[model samples]
Target: MYYIGIDLGTSAVKLLLVDEEGSITSTVSKSYAVEYPRPGWSQQNPADWWEAVTAGARELMAGVDTAQVRAIGTGGQMHGLVALDAAGEVIRPCILWNDGRTEEEVCFLNETIGRERLSGLAGNIAFAGFTAPKLLWMRKHEPDNFARIAHIMLPKDYLTFRLTGEFATDYSDASGTLLLDVEHRCWSAEMLEICGVSEAQMPRLMDGAEAVGTLSAAAAQELGLPAGTVVAAGAGDNAAAAVGCGAVAAGSCNISLGTSGTIFIPSDGFRVDAHNALHSFDYVEGRYHLMGCILSAASCSGWFVGDVLKAEDFDAEEAASDPAVATVDLPYFLPYLMGERSPHNDTAARGAFVGMRADTSRAQMVRAVREGVAFAIRDCVEVARGEDIRIERSTLCGGGSKSALMRQTLANVLNIELDLPETEQGPGYGAAMLAMVAAGDAPSVEACVGRIVRMRGSVVPDPQAVAAYEERYQIWRQMYPALKPIYRQMAR
Candidate 1:
């Protein structure tokens, strides 16, 4: 049996083919444009997603035995609001997850509606990216369109619909909507009322491994697959990555640093942080997970190396960065180029270099970018620790994990060992594993991971490095608090 996993990302749809043995046979990607009509607003057409996916799938299976393909799953960008009219036509370009256009709506829910009330109803509070807030923004700004709405879907659920002709979503994806009673694994009536939307507008809730349906004839012909290929209700990208890293067990963790960075911690039962800094969401393991998202992660490094520094030799620059200069406080940086989430949900926060000195060298500044990212990640770990989710070691995957300096810093600054997965395909690999479970090729997600997910090696923290990072981390924690007031003032 063969499974295909699609990672519906912010910039592209990445398709991966995995054989029964769990080896990735082939991988293909197709990019789509993200529109920014207004500052702080982001949108994308659902049609671009469909086209990329179908085209990518054809290429992914170009030389493979199509007859062996049995199931399809996806790890999708979460919390984008995709609306449909009565005839199932897209109402508008989806309001993407990183968009900040719903700030008014978020304030209404977090303040007027009240945080405690929202949390009680949805097991989470409103963030600008959440679906419920997006619904409010639409109702206020696009009332005519809201009245014509027949369906409200997340990004991947939209793809699932096009494939199986089923209006369905999995718990892991639904958890980001702020419309689900996450603890109960169902939509919250209170949330719907507050958002001025209806339950009928939402996709039918399905488990991540539940077979949404066999592919429709129309979809089959377009993608060159069997007419009845099984389509599993897939997970949000982070949860799927968790499944990929074998982080389904309690106390297990997976850190992904792609467009955004997150610390994912799985739990058997639902548990929300008292302050609501951490997001409590359903996991692909048929359980729950708590996640802290940093809006800027690897993108920060990409911007610095590829854009600002114009340096092609990233490895060479990393190698040139001396740890001795890292000891100086002259090159401190905060990784908030595109605003922040996770520990600080402030979208208005701006990036800064607090301790810049005339003596600061270009290499030290480069090292600061790497170290700053690691510090931001540790900020998330600090929030998790507050909630009693202890972390002595964690499995890591992401573009950032490939950097030896960053990984070593993560191990020491976060003060934990970082286990690296052998099949580091991340979310795409996990989505394929979900397909395996849906196809009945595996008993459970955990069982599938144990058999297929291999451990390559682990990065352990040296006592000296840990001690040094502890001092810097103490300083890192203070930077946010000292700068937070300025962040809000600038926003005003």
Candidate 2:
């Protein structure tokens, strides 16, 4: 049997065709645009996502035996709010996950509503990127649109609705909404009330590997797949990627450096951090995980290289970078381009180059960008460490992980062994595994991953690099606190 997995990413829809044996047969990607209407706001059209997924699926299954396909699953960007009207039409362009337009709402929830109260209701406290804050932002600024919202879902669930005509979401994805009582794997009544949204507006919650519904006839025809193919309730991108990396067992760790960076630590049971610095969310394994998210990761380097420098080749830039200069304390970068999330929940924070000199070369800046991301991720690692979770090794995946410098930098900065997966297709590969479980080809997520996921190699931290990064990381930590006042002032 064949399974189709769709990764509804921030910038593209990646479709994968996998056979029962766990090998990716074919893959296709379709890109879309993210709109930045204002300095800090990010949004995207839901129609564009639908068009991309359908087009990519057709291309993915071209000349293949469509009848052999059994199930379809999706893993997508989490926490983006997608509202629909009564007629099931998109209410507006989706308020994207990286959007920082909810500072007021976030402050209202974390301060006015009280962090303790919010944390008790939802496993997490309010962040600007969370769905509840977005809802509050809409209610106050765009009341007409808020009133028109008959349905509320995350980015990937929007695709699930398009494929199966089902208003449903998986636990891992729902966990990010700040409307879910993540401990119970259900929507929180108090959170719903706080957001001024009805429970009816929420999607039905399911396990990541469970079937939401079968593909609708129209959707099947559009994608050139069988009408009755099962549609699995997929996971959030990070959760799905962890599963793909075989990080299903308790205490397992996975680090991702996609648009955002995250240190995902799976737990066998629910465990919320004392300060709520890290996100406590449901894992794809039907348990829990602690995640520390960095708002900017690979995107930081992409922006600096592609936009600012007007250069397309990242490898060429990295090749010329002086590794020796990276050890010095003069030049440092804060990867808060879209504001920070984990460790520091400051939305007013902006990216800055703290120290530079006349002789500072573009190569040195490139090295700074890469090392800056590594240092930011280490911030989250420290949080997990505070919770008494010792992470000695972790599986790594994502666009940034493809960089030898990044992988080694992360290993050295965090001082952890980094395992490289054989097939690092990210969430799409795990979404396909979820499809296998939904179709009864696999017993569970654990079993599916056990059979499919394999470690191809590992990157061990260099002792000298680790020592140098330890010093630099301490200095990097001081930069954020020192700039907090300035960041707030600049926001005005």
Candidate 3:
């Protein structure tokens, strides 16, 4: 039998076909544009996402036995707000997760509403990228659209609804919405009231592994799948990626380097830090995890190399930096191109290059871009360490992980062994595994992950490199606080 997994990402939709043995049989991707009508705003048409998923699914299942396909699951970008009208039509472009237009709303939540109360209610504080801030932004600036919101869902849940005719979302995805009472696994009544939304506007919440419904006949026909194929309530990208990397066990960690970066550590109990710097969310495996998200990661590298440098060969550009000079004099890049989340939570934060010399080469700047991202991830690791979460090792996956330089830099900077998974499909693969559980092809999430996920190799930290990075990280850490005032001024 076969299962289909969909990864509804920021820039593209990726579909995977996996057999009962957990091997990927086919993959298809379809790209779409992200609209930016104004600075700090990011949006996408829901119609664009649905069009891409259906097209990608048809291509993925080409020449495969249709009868063998048993289930469908999805792992999607989290926190995006997809508002729907009474007739089930999209009200407007979805406010994407990376959009920084919620600064005012975030400040209102964190300051006016009080972070302590927000954390107590939602198990997290408001950030510009979360779904609650977006809702508040809409109610304040686009009141008409807000009034028409008969239903609200995340990006992947919208796809799931289209597939199964079920308005439901998994806890892993809902946890990022700031509307969920994450500790108790329900929608927070106070939060809903604060956002001027009712519980009726929310989708039904389910565990990530639960079967929401079967595919609708129209959806099955459009995607070339069977009508009765099971559809699992999927997870947020980070949680699903953790499952893909087999990081479901207590204290096991996974670091992702996709469009956004995250350090995900799954735990069996629910716990929140004193400052609420890390997100406390329900994991795909039905427990809890702490995750720190950086708004820019691989995309920073992409922007530097492609847009700033106008270069096509990323490998060649990355390969040009001198290792010796890199450790000593290279400028520190902030890696905050699209503002930031996690410990800082500053939407006004802007990317900058500090300590640059007159003779600084482009190669060194390129190296700084990579090092900057590594340093940003280290910021998260340090927070986890504050809570006594010792991450001696972690599974690594995503587009940036394919770079040998990035892998070694991350290992040394983090001072942790980074494991490479044999099947590095991340969310797409984990989504497939969720489908298996829903179909009874696997006994449980843990059992399926244990049987299928395998490590390909490891990248151990170099002691000397670790020492150098530690010194550099200390200097880099001081830059953010010093620049915070300037960022706010620039925003004004």
Using Cα atoms with residue i matched to residue i, what is each candidate's TM-score against the true structure? 0.98, 0.99, 0.99
Q: Write the per-residue lDDT of candidate 2 for residues 162-281, one digit (tens) a residue.
A: 999999999998999999999988899999998999999999999999999999999999988899999999999999999888999997899999999998999989989989999999
Clashing pairs in 2: none
Cα misplacement distance, residue 454 of candidate 2 (Å): 0.6
lDDT of candidates 1 onward, in order: 0.88, 0.92, 0.92
lDDT of the structure predicted as candidate 1: 0.88
Tens-place lDDT per residue, model 1, 117-203, is: 988988888887888889999999999999999999999999999999899999999999999999999999988988888898889
Cα miss at 472, model 2 (Å)?
0.9
Write the candidate numbers in order of decreasing lDDT: 3, 2, 1
Each candidate: how many clashes?
A: 0, 0, 0
Winner by lDDT between candidate 2 and candidate 1: 2
